[model samples]
Target: MTKNISKEIPKEKRFLIMVILLTGVFFTLLNETLLNLAIPVLVNEMDAAPSTVQWVVTGYMLIMGVFIPVSSLMIQWFTTRQLFIGSLVLFSVGSLVSGLAAALPYLFIGRFFQAMGTALLLPLMMHTLLMLYPAKKRGTVMGFIGLVIMVAPAIGPPLSGVILDFLNWRWLFFMMLPLIFLVLISSIFVLDNVTTVTRPKIDIRSILFSIFGFGGIVFGLSFAGDESVSWLNPSVYISLCVGLVCLSGFVWRQLKSVTPMLEMRTFRHPMFSLAALLLFIGMMTQFSTIILLPFLFENALGVSTVAAGLILLPGAIINGAISPFIGRIFDKFGPKILVIPGMILLVIGLQLFIKVNTATSILMFILLYTLVMIAIAMIIMPAQTNGLNQLPAKYYSHGTAIFNTLQQIAGATGIAFYVTMMSVGQNLYPSTSGIIGGAGRYSRCRDTVCF
Candidate 1:
């Protein structure tokens, strides 16, 4: 049966499947960051505080983090087509709910639904890609996936800025509705089941541990930067401690269980472990820059929101455009050559920001930012593909799920850590001159702290 199915799937059909999957994945990811600029608008319109309104973003991240661990199990239980179509439908409904939301609570609920769909979509796409392509060809294919990952978030702020220039916050969701519905409908006809489904018994305890474990950590880290939430507060410490304990239990349960929720044994491979570490660090740095750059542009350099977005746009575009080529290089030469140089470039790019001051040129900023993007383009996809390549076919879904979940956690933690550092620096310095005198302090602090 597997042989027949493989023979029946022509190259064109495979390409079409990729197109459909990438379309769904792209829009879902695009929606993830689209609402960032709209937060202020939502806060004012809904008469909610910044922290309360932030649940729109936080809720999505939380749900995604919580659900990602189970995605490995879900893939085992469901057909690819079934999961793909269901995720798209769920995403469409969530978008509709958010677009038509009458209050803050409705928006949060909608965002939660959106997140559920996204959690499935991300790992599903990667798992499908791994199934369709061989390891040798994976670098090139994953590079395109890298394009989606890198470009979507990068363009999100600018895209939102442009949309809000003429339209309101709700239109953000409304505009996505048609595209999502179109993709959802198309996928129904073209998508086919790739992974063989095995009916595994759902472990209820594992589910609870996963929810509290992952959810608690992400929630605590996300709220760590809030002025109202102190590091010394019980809520913060309690959540982190509970998260750690539950996650430990979850790990122990997985090791003993007949069918683990996620295959922890993937880490037994040295290459996979190293790749995961590199991916984690890369995600942390990428997210920190995403959070920090806009503030530096607008607050310190006096650039407009639109201008800041514009400044970041070109670098993202170039980075995304070149990703496929980088993937080809990875396929031909392998990761060692690409990753080492990429890391060097990455460190150099970060170092450039260490001495940023009032006199730093926007042109220089653009160049350095583009360099960072380029370095990330070279590293992220190749490292991820190489890591998964080390795993056996049976572990594909679990491997992808584990890697993605950690990526999300890293992103949330990075944002929380960097924001807190920035806030503390602001409080300690209290004036623009004070900040400038210690202009290199922010980057130095981040280096010492995060690295």
Candidate 2:
């Protein structure tokens, strides 16, 4: 969309700039789920229930949902250097807070800061990268980012697995502080202003609506996913209703505002809308697997945290390795070339997962998970690049923000739905089969299944 933009900037300088964004992205994305491996450990060490401890992961995502929409406005209001440096600093502070945390609530405080940092950085990277490269090259660059998205979590779990194996759970955050600081320092030399600052008027009411709107929805979804909470529970229905109501108000506020925080009209483009919907579905399924596999391995299949963490490594690595090439293909071809087969591949993988059980071989699990991950790598970035390509250049920031905002919410929603579905199903049967038994119930409970 940035047709005839500044290719005048030295290619090497651009490369350095991209490296900074990617490294930050890798760290943020890693922290997003690095704790999956640490969950069991945190549960025991922190003296928290499994459900409560899980929020460390879910809260990070939900918080991202709250802030990402505002990033589009921030992109216009601040210099790229200011946003990047500030976000990394906040994330570092969060990591230090988390590493020093002595209690679960303290971890939430730290994670809040961490999530805020990530929420800003993720969209900023995409928006900045788009400003750096034109449409012709986006596929390959976004593909590289796909490598980070696919590989960071792949690496995070096993890496954290080893850390948890040898060190305290707090080391997870402590380990990230150095990486954050390195990126922070690197950004000082390379980060520059890319977009023009309009210094748009801040809509105070819309901000509140977004906070409560997205927050309420994430909260309701979290509650809905808990097996212990009945559908009729006041917490469940009331939260969901309030969330819906606030979200509706938020949408109205956006549509009515001339200078909306998030320009709701980006959906006017059919391709962007379609792309957003598909991206949401893809992230949900991918995250569901990302979160669930560790649970199945360590809890259901009786694997070690280390082994559970390592299980997903191979396929994800392969996906990371090939993603760039896949991007090249997208550059030459187009979205349908990737999206069609990727969707079919994903559906097939999900079908196979339905039959998975405690006895399923680790290699088999890896193979199936790889199928899903590759499908995701194929679909996620290319589809997003393709969708953004369709939009007017002015809407690029809003499009990136929307893409990221939906992505975070989708991760939270997907995790909540699938996790609760499995728990609900497993509790119904009360078997040693764990997620497999849940899958079985899911198959029969057609109206309420996620397998």
Candidate 3:
């Protein structure tokens, strides 16, 4: 809506806008975990490095970290409808490019486009949601949105798993095209601009720093596990150094700027800082497990792709089923009550993940994964709400933005770390125990064999 419109939008209009935005959100989130089961298949089908194959996931999120800061800029420079169409177009093109890709580099290019679409859609949805809901009702409203939002990712593995069983990995991206087309048509006809351009101050330096900083770090993490590369490879260390130096510059610039891209001061609130830390850790856990389990079941234990997806399904379902209720529980009791127990459960769950081996039962892994998801559901929103509560009204806008940006970065780092560790362990013991999965993964003769 232009600034020319009424303060309160009509209910029918609000519902249409929300439905369109949520559809976009669902598509973006679904792609996030959909490819976990596809990684091994891509490695075999494309003759790509397993480590590099991970870029399909990390590259997407890295682009997200870069653009999330710029989302505000996008809103100011364009109308809500303009931004919405732009994001959808980016996603559509990305899906098409990725589906047609014949090599790893081409796939990366497609993922980059998709990530940009996703980065923009997230903040836009939040902006529309905030405008539509009143203050007191937003908590419950967000709770319900959280319910729907969380389910998309939860179901991704199973959905993709079914696809992988019958089709090529390209179908993962191909399947989304029809849905994207439908959303584009509906949005063009039904969705209207919600807000006009506000033309905020631009910070070129801040954007540059974030790009180089997060980019360097994720690049470093992605390579750290490649058995072909030395631990001392410049691609690993130099990129890391550049990322760190650039990120330091980004932080300094944010602190010095009068109109920072992200508000650094919100962190001064003790609760906000604490909650950010907790959420960061939680995000790391969620991402690492999502990648690791599929690798374990499919690659290590020799489980079928459909079977692996089915194994992860229970955890996904349990996580989605309980989320909205968890929000209600938080509303009634407050964060500490949930956060404390959630932390306990998360810790216990991670500990059990360590116990997983080729011999571990499918049922046992399901229980462990479900517990972790449940803990995460408990921690993420409630802690976020509590932390935002610590800030005054003025910081609310940037507060949420900063929080989301950090989560994307955290997820990238987590996936890179886990992928690297798996590579490292595979490299160190490829011959010692005659393990099946890791042995076959890096074997030069195209089959598992001892050195």
lDDT of 2 by residue, 159-222 (tens): 8877877899888999898888888988898787787678999988888888888877777777
User: In model 3, what is the error at residue 375, expressed in angstroms?
Assistant: 0.9
Q: Candidate 3: give the clashing pairs.
A: 1-193, 1-194, 1-195
Candidate lDDT scores, in order, read 0.84, 0.82, 0.75
Q: Which ranges of candidate 2 are over 4 A from the true structure?
A: 1-4, 43-45, 354-359, 432-450
Model 2 vs truth, CA RMSD: 3.0
- How far is each candidate from the true structure, as Cα RMSD in Å? 2.3, 3.0, 5.1
Clash number for each model? 0, 0, 3
Compared with the true structure, the alpha-carbon lDDT of candidate 3 equals: 0.75
Better of 1 and 3 by lDDT: 1
Q: Which stretches of candidate 1 lie over 4 Å from their true place?
A: 1-8, 432-451
Question: What is the Cα-based lDDT of residue 422 in candidate 1?
Answer: 72
Give lDDT tens digits, candidate 1, residues 274-371.
98999988888888777778776766666888798789888888888998999999899999989999999998888776665567788988898899
Candidate 3, poorest ten consecutive residues by summed lDDT: 442-451
Better of 2 and 3 by TM-score: 2
How well does each candidate superpose onto the true structure, as a TM-score?
0.95, 0.92, 0.84
